[model samples]
Target: MLAALRGIAAPPDLPLIQRRNFLRVQIDAIGVGLASAAAPFLPIFLTRLGATSQEVSYLTSMPALTGLLLGIAIGQLLQKQRNIVRWFSAARFLVLLAYAVTALLIEVVPSAWLIRAILLLWALVTLPQTVVAVSFNVVMNGVAGPQHRYDLMSRRWSILGITMAITTAVAGQLLEHLPFPLNYQIVFSLLSLGSLISFAFSSKIELPPQPISNASRTNSVFTRLSHLLGQIWREKPFVRFVSIRFIFLIGTTLAAPLFPLYYVREVKASDAWIGIFNTAQTAVLLVGYFAWTMISRARGSRFTLLVTTFGVSLYPILVAHTHQVQVIALIAGVAGFFQAGIDLVFFDELMKTIPDGQSAIFVAVAQTLTHLSSFIAPIASAWLSDLYSLPIALTLSGIIRFLGFGLFLTLGRKDS
Candidate 1:
């Protein structure tokens, strides 16, 4: 901890508080690490616990489904209270507990019904993490400012990507070496420890002052939401930007639910292999993140996003074509490279659309929409994949990317 603080304090341009924020961001990276570590293996974990492809698809949808309902409520709560650090702390703790439960009870759970129940329970446990995501983005936006948001998010993700990549690689090795259920148990154990570290780090963060008024506080949050809607409608560029984002999200999410199932069922990759694939992807992402951090600083977020979007637009096609393991890994690496850039650009652009003093609202709205899209994706993708094929779904995803490109060319042109 002292080492982290000392490291943060050494940055030339950072003030004392900025230095503290930097440490917090690094601490926040631990949660990012846990999530990333789980990402590659979670589908396999479900499979080991007797989940089918359809069940895996549904499980993938659970977090977004839970977030769709809970995210808005969390946003409203953040609007009233300024103790965001505490909210973040609570969220991490819940997520940690959830991981522990999933690790301990996964083998004992009986029937598909039990699997579904556990998934929903897992989703419930992770909802606060979603809330914490919005809070983190909102708070960080304020702290970092628009100019620095690009740099901050990039640097933070770079560090996060590095940490997560290392952890994932190590976990992958452990999985490769360990036995069936025990391997998963060990992975989840690591995740729980990471979450606890994240919680402890979050607890050290200083809370900012609340800005809501007495009258505003007394009024119903719905009325405030209505006013916010009015403002959103009144602001043409903001509306356009958000509309474009929503459209892009819909297209991007179309095949998301099927991805895990595609790898598990179609490709027939083992848990260890999946972890290795993820490690390869994260390695690519780490490189991409650092490269973009440099480019985002030089070229601006708009330019960075445009280039990255074009690159990301190609991944589905790559994924659709690949048959060999090495080819798949290469494809994944390519996707990761572009995704790092896309994420940095997306956040930077989104921050610009948020109204002053209402960062949390817009951030929450974006998150809500994202989760809603994710929730809908599984059913839609599953139906489509059943009717046509996963290739068709990928084709559809590509088309959506092209549409997003069109939006960028026409509507978002000036913003960029």
Candidate 2:
């Protein structure tokens, strides 16, 4: 327990903190900036290409499904790689090119059927995309060290908030002004360039070399994965932590695929409205970094998580029931404040749960379960919204979130 407690303390020196912060922030700003600007908009773009409701959900869920399938393999790769950062760069750099091509081809193929083809090609890139993403936290943990995880995470997310605020504001204007499809084409291509720059910074990041742990490659692949699972099962606290996280995750993420449709159709929100909403949320979210840090330092991550999670649940539930776009948009900004806690603490706890040199194994198991949840969440939310009312499905999501928090409060109290 004392060992785990040490994970939350500040680093011993200033120089180490600064180096990690610089490299870490560059990675965060670029990674979250690209994904938030691109992936979330995919469902919106799918609708423009004449995709049905079902098709949008399938395409949205495809990436996470790939993550679920490939996470353990990526975990093993991380275990063996001499330089994990280079491996990530290779895969993700390819993705940036794929994204650029995807954006350009939208204008090239204006046909309705051809649009579907383009989107399918886009979905196929999710494989490499998933690979880089699963390894992301492991890289951060390796670089930041447990002592600086909270500092790195809080500042990293603040950069993300700032990036999203600017990107959404700018992209929203371009989409609103430029001609159909061409607007999306130009914007996505430009965002890919931003990621290209981030990669340049990523190459300069310094990580102490990790020697390969297991040299015996004679075993079959399934044999290796089965062995990893056994090791995780031995970690009782880690297993409990992951289980509680999934419950809350399911409750909140249930609304992912439904959001674009909900905002446009039910709330009748304009493109500009989304820009304003995201900007407002980011403003609060950015300021929230300092506040959550204080809370995490004083009250502990467990308390911060429990308190803020309840607030986070309200955003979706509030959006589901409300008809006023302006009202919900403000609510969205307030909700961003709570998300700061979740963001800062979630990984802090993960880092604490495992001993040193074990980030990849722990994160792989956690992400694999999360990807599985992401796979089911949107489909369930969509089906429920269709069968009953979206309001009903979203309300139930909020209620279920409280149950997760309740369980977390009970299970996490002792260690936290």
lDDT of each: 0.72, 0.74
**After superposition, which runs of candidate 2 have C-alpha atoms over 4 Å from their true positions?**
1-12, 16-24, 27-35, 96-98
Clashing pairs in 1: none
**Per the 3 Å backbone cut-off, how many clashing residue pairs does candidate 2 have?**
0
Among all windows of 10 consecutive residues in model 2, the one with the lowest summed lDDT is 2-11
lDDT of 1 at 6: 48
Candidate 2 lDDT: 0.74
lDDT digits (tens) for residues 1-416 of candidate 1: 79655474235476677667767767777676775576657666776677765677766577777778888777877877767667767776777666667776656676555577667776666677687767877766755766677556766776677777778778877887898778877787667677777777667766466576565567686897787678667767667766676766666777676566667667776555666667777777667876887897887666786788777777776777665667777777888888898887787778877777777766777788778877786667777887888777877877788788677767545676
TM-score of 1: 0.91
Candidate 1 regions exceeding 4 Å error are 1-11, 111-114
